[model samples]
Target chain A: MRYLKLIKVFIKTSAQETLMYRANFWVSLLHAFLNLIVAVLALVILFGQTENLNGWNLSSTLSLLGVYLIVSAIRNLFIGPSLEALVGLGQEVWNGQFDFTLLRPVNTQFLITFRIWRLFSLIDLFLGGAVLLYSIFQTPQSPNLLAWLLFLLALVAGILILYAILLAFTALVFWNPGYLFTWVFDAIFQLARYPLGIYPVGVRIFLTWIIPVGVITTIPAQVISGQTGAPIVFLILAASVFLFLFASWLFNKGIKQYHSASS
Target chain B: MNHRGGFALIKATWFSWMQYRSFFFVLAFGWMIPPLVALFVWSAAAGEGSLGGFTRGEFITYYLVLVLVNQITYAQVNWTVGDIIREGTLNHWLLKPLSAIYQALSSELAGKVVYLIFVIPVGLLLAILLKPEIQTTPINFVLSLVATLFAWGLRFAWGFWLAILAFWITRADSFLALQDSLVFIFSGMVAPIPLLQGSLQQIANILPFRYMVGFPVEILVYDLSNKAILFGFLMQLTWLAIAVLLSRTLWVKGIRHYSAVGG
Candidate 1:
């Protein structure tokens, strides 16, 4: 409950900060629209060549893209902005301002995770939802109530898994403050925009087991698309929980290694 | 222009950039993801047959070369040019004895050096593993290299002009995102231009965006007729000339606007 209140305060402050730059809203909207157009155009061109890609049809692939957009928007909304401040180029950890964050009474991870928000990503979220709904209608399978419930659960797990991966990358910043580790992860994460089955077997296994970006978007998409069942959701839920706990442990260990520049 | 000063600047930039080679390597890897994803998707679609005259092996080779070509031609320094103008740091560059353009060029060359160190090895590894179809003659390879150089010039000059627009509008960086979307669609990143429909193919041919990254890759990967290759080069030169013209004219006008705004 205390953490909830803290999150509200953090969000309020973040919203206030965002409101000062109203033009950014328009810029983000235009970017979101352009990104949607570009992604859909790619799908259209690909579908023009063939009926399906590795069993994923135009509608299903669009769903995967929709999931990608939603997950990306969520990341941009909080996970990205907060972590970028904490560990991105020449930011808090590099400049030693992270010491202030550490000295605060709040749990460092919780505070850092919720401190900053780019509200403009809300537009992206809306656009993603629109695409998801439109794609769902376009597909032959209409997800029932139970499938929708599973979709929601899998979506949460997907978000958690993504957060864990990014957090793990962020922790590496403590070991090498000069290196922007998340950029590598960001590259791999782009693979999740497509169905994992399209990749070669070795690369698919690597993305699924090593990075797990494959499942981060794929499983939720699979469930709602009526390609998989509830068992997969449980499996991914376990993975998400495990990944989050491991990431938190890594972050804590990294925090212990910090040597403040000011100190 | 002092050739010695330019050489010294590039060398100094390279040395400074070496300190963050790992970070740049990560960024380069990230840049490779979109093309890599397309490669897998298209290759998988081409399994056991051909798509638009491209076998699975041909798809692999096309993207593998594209990964290298795109990395070489990508103008990352253009992103910083906007910040330089917006933050009023252009004044310092102007004060330098050497041309201010060298500052951007030095970083661009240095970054390419750092990034290619990582990109080339990975591209080679992929080529070895995937066994991309190598279908290039000596003459074609040499001509492709020239086309790639022209591509880099066009991409850089085009982006430079967009960045210079920062002197006139506070949100000029948005144009960069717009440019990226255009490149993603009109360029062969999404799909090969030959694979595109009649009108879309014509659009791709006409757009300057394809000349940036796609033309060079296609030149090396595809066995184009002599007339086709000549047409590609003609289009490449035309766009490069236009880009250079725009960049030069914009810089002069932007500088005037900058001083008028008391920059």
Candidate 2:
């Protein structure tokens, strides 16, 4: 409960920073719309040639893309911005300014993970939700309330999986702050924009188990499209919980590994 | 342009950038994922059957070659040109002994050299494992190389001009992001140009985007008529010329505008 209020305060301050750059909102809106158009255009062209790709059709794939956008927006909103403040290009750890963050009264992980935000990404969140809604309606059978509940559960799992993965990568900054470790992760994450089944078995296994980007987007999409079982959803929820705990442990280990750059 | 000075600058840039080769390699791998995803998706779609005149083997070859072509022509340097202009760093470039372009050019060449070190081996490994089928004459290969050079020139000049707009507008990077989306859609990254239907095919053929990365790959992989290859080259050269003109004009005008603001 205390953490929730802290997040609200963090968001309020971030909102003030965002509002100072009004043009950025318009730029972000345009970027979101352009990204949507590109995604939809690609789908239109792909589906135009073949009715379905592997077992996934255009609508199901669009659902995956929508989930991808939502996950990405959520990352951009807080997960990306906050962690990026610590370890991104020319950021805190790079410049030895992270000592200031460590000196704060709050927990280091909690502060670093929630203190900064790019509110402009809220535009992408709305656009993604709209796409998901539209794609859901386009399906032959609309999701029932239970399906919606499952979808939300899977979506939350997906987001947590992504967060854990990013947090693990962010923690690597302690070992080597010069390299942007998240970039390699970003490359792998791009694969999540499509259904995992479309990849070769070997590649699919790697993305699903090693990186789990497949679990981050494909499972939630599968739930929305009514292609997944409830057990699988709960299984993913458990897996995400485990991954989060492991990542938190790794972050704490990394915190201990941190040596002040200034000294 | 002083050829000796430019050569020296590129050497210096390459050695300086060697320290960050791993980062560039990761970025290159990220750039390769989209085409790799397309390759797998199209190959799976074409299992036991063809999609839009492309067999599974042909799809494999097309995207394998495309991975190399896309990496070669991609203008990663242009991403920083806007920052250089906006952050008052352009003044440093202006005072350099070599032409201002050498600053951009050196980084561009060094980045390609670094990125290709990773991209080529991965592409070759994928090709060997995937077993891409190819039947191209030496003449076709030579023409494809020439087309690739033209494509790089067109893409670099076009993106440079867009970045130069930072002298007038604070948010010129938005335009760069918009251009990337357009290129991804029209440049046959999503699907082979041959697979595109009616108006979309015509639009892609007419746009400068296809001339950037897709035309060269299409030349090498697709069995096109002489007239079609000639037309592709013609369009590519025309766009390159136009882009060069625009880049030159924009730099001159933008420098005047920038100096006025500073003065």
Per-candidate DockQ vs. reference: 0.83, 0.83
What TM-score does the first chain of candidate 2 have? 0.96
Writing each residue's lDDT as its tens digit, candidate 1 over B155-222 gives 99988888898888889888999999989888899898889888999999999989999999888989
Residue B206, candidate 1: Cα error in Å is 0.5
Q: Cα miss at A109, model 1 (Å)?
A: 2.9
lDDT (tens digit, per residue) of candidate 2 on B75-163: 97678998888888788898888898989999999988998899888988998899999999899999999999999989899889998
TM-scores of chain B alone in all candidate structures, in the order given: 0.96, 0.97
Q: Which residue runs of candidate 1 sit more than 4 Å off their true CA positions? A: B260-263
Q: What are the clashing pairs of model 2?
A: none
Worst 10 residues of 1 chain A by lDDT: A178-187
lDDT score for residue B163 of model 2: 88
- The positional error of residue B128 in candidate 2, measured at the CA in angstroms, is 1.3
Task: After superposing candidate 2 on the true structure, give the runs of residues whose Cα lies further than 4 Å from its correct spot.
Answer: A88-90, B260-263
lDDT of 2 at A201: 89
